[model samples]
Target: MDVQGVRAAYRRYARHYDRYFGKVFHDGRKLAIEQMAILPGEHVLEVGVGTGLSLPEYPDGVRVTGIDLSPEMIQHAQTRVEDLELPDVTLLEMDASAMEFSDASFDHVVAMYVLSVAPEPERVIAEMRRVCKPGGRLYIVNHFRNANRIISSLERALAPLSQLLGFRPDFSLDEFVAHNDLDVLEAHPVNLFGYWTLLTAAREPTCRGGASPDLERSIRSH
Candidate 1:
């Protein structure tokens, strides 16, 4: 889907996102966090954190930063943070494919129901890997194309409508994992009827250095 098209579609959905998606995807959200095994004081970055639905699920004392592309959706997330008086939570309107955070800035990075919606899933995963510490974990929760012939066919048939639906229905998990070179630790079905999946992986240390001093310095200065 086009980035602008996604932004426009989500702008309309932001107001009623919770009503439609909150309860339906709650289990996947919970499972993803549980598997992360987050430790206190670990810095966590959540990509595509629409409306902050998973904000309260994170344990206290972990610094949490969430980013989304849609300004309209992020406004709701900001409100959720303020309403809950959550300390150490930051919300920003930003694109996942090109994040501003310094390399290895976060201990853990997560993206829930975001891969299929991203205009470039590979770039988004690359950014997630770049910002995350080597030993840190990465979690993803999303729906992939079904295995059943009929269901899979239906998903492919609906791919053309993604611009209107805000997400592609025919995203492939196997291709995504292979293309991104993900080192998956575990994969499990989540949500009703096993429609969604939760995947966990570790960020392998890159030969490159840790957090970029210039980037971190700029981020701190702001």
Candidate 2:
């Protein structure tokens, strides 16, 4: 889906999104934040922070900057920040694939249920790696294509309906991991029936010249 399509879909869903997905996805959000282990005064970035459902879960003293492409979704998030009196949170209407922050701007970055919906998942991952400081944590939670044959086939069949649902049903975890030079720390299932996977990785420090040529080649080859 294109940016405009994403915006339109989320705009239409913003009012009722929580009603539909809030509790269902709450566990993954909580788990991701807990795993972050955000220290006091650290800066965190959340890409595709729809409606700020996870804002209140963050502890005090840590600053959070959340970005999403949908203005309507951001409006709801803004209201959430106000209602909760979350002084350290900020929400912006911005694209995840092309962030405007300086390099290594955040101490930690997370994207829950976003990769499958982003227009360019690889570009989004690159930007996530770019803005995160070396050794910083990266967390992702999303529903990936099931490995089970029957379910995998069902997901593939429903892939075209993403234009209406706002997320692709056939996103593959193996493909995403292979295409990005990420230092994966851990990956586990979350939510009911193990429908969502929580992935944790770290941004490796850049070498003298740049990232290792071999790593770049491997990612490109994939």
Candidate 3:
């Protein structure tokens, strides 16, 4: 799927997207965010921050930078930021597979229900790992092929259209995480048939240094 095309499609539905999908999506988001346990004074990067629904959960003084591929979604998100009085939050149009930042740039990275919709989910995950601080967590809440024989068969039938529509490829997440070598700290299955997994993991701390001076300097200067 063309990521830009998906972004454009979302724009046409931006006004009602949340209202229609909020219950299902936010239920997943709430579960993921709670597991993240975002704290005060942390610098967070929210990838694919459509409509900024996660904005309210972040505590004050926790700096946030959100990036999305959709400009229209960002417009509505900006209003939410303003109305919520979240002055420190920033949103920009960006692609998840190609972030413009140095390594270890963020204290935490979140992609809520984001990976499955990306054209290249593995590449996007690698990018998320690259920008995240060595010890900082990468959190993902995603829907995958259901386990039931009936539902799984249906997914197989619709696989082509779903892939073309930016749905995830049929892959085992356990194998993916293992291949990536991330230390999985938590994994919880949500909804019936265990279709969604809220996962958190970190890079091995053995290679991590203390906080980057440049990161600290940038935060202080802000």
The TM-score that candidate 1 achieves is: 0.91
Report the lDDT tens digits of candidate 3 across residue range 1-222. 778667766777679867966666666677766776778877889898989988887777888899988888888899999998898898998999899978998888989877777767777888888998877888888775555568668777777775344455454564456555656676677644445777777745323233222221222233
Clashes of each: 0, 0, 0
What's model 2's lDDT at 58? 95
TM-score of each: 0.91, 0.91, 0.83
Candidate 2 runs further than 4 Å off: 205-222
Worst lDDT run of 10 residues, candidate 1, spans 211-220
What lDDT score belongs to each candidate, Candidate 1 first? Answer: 0.86, 0.87, 0.74
Put down candidate 1 lDDT per residue, 101-216, tens digits, no spaces: 99999998999999999999889998999999977888999898886689989999999999999999998776666666677677787899877888887786333333222221
Candidate 1 Cα misplacement greater than 4 A, ranges = 205-222
As for model 1, its CA RMSD to the true structure in angstroms is 9.5
Error of 2 at 154 (Å): 0.7
lDDT score of model 3?
Answer: 0.74
Whichever of 1 and 3 has more TM-score, that candidate is 1
Model 1 accuracy (lDDT, Cα) = 0.86
Q: Candidate 3: which pairs clash?
A: none
Worst 10 residues of 3 by lDDT: 211-220
Q: For residues 1-222, could you state the per-residue lDDT of candidate 2 as single tens digits?
A: 989889889989999999998999999999999999999999999999999999999999999999999998899999999988999998998999999999999999999999999988889999998999987878989888886789989999999899898999998776666667666677768899767888888776223332333322232233
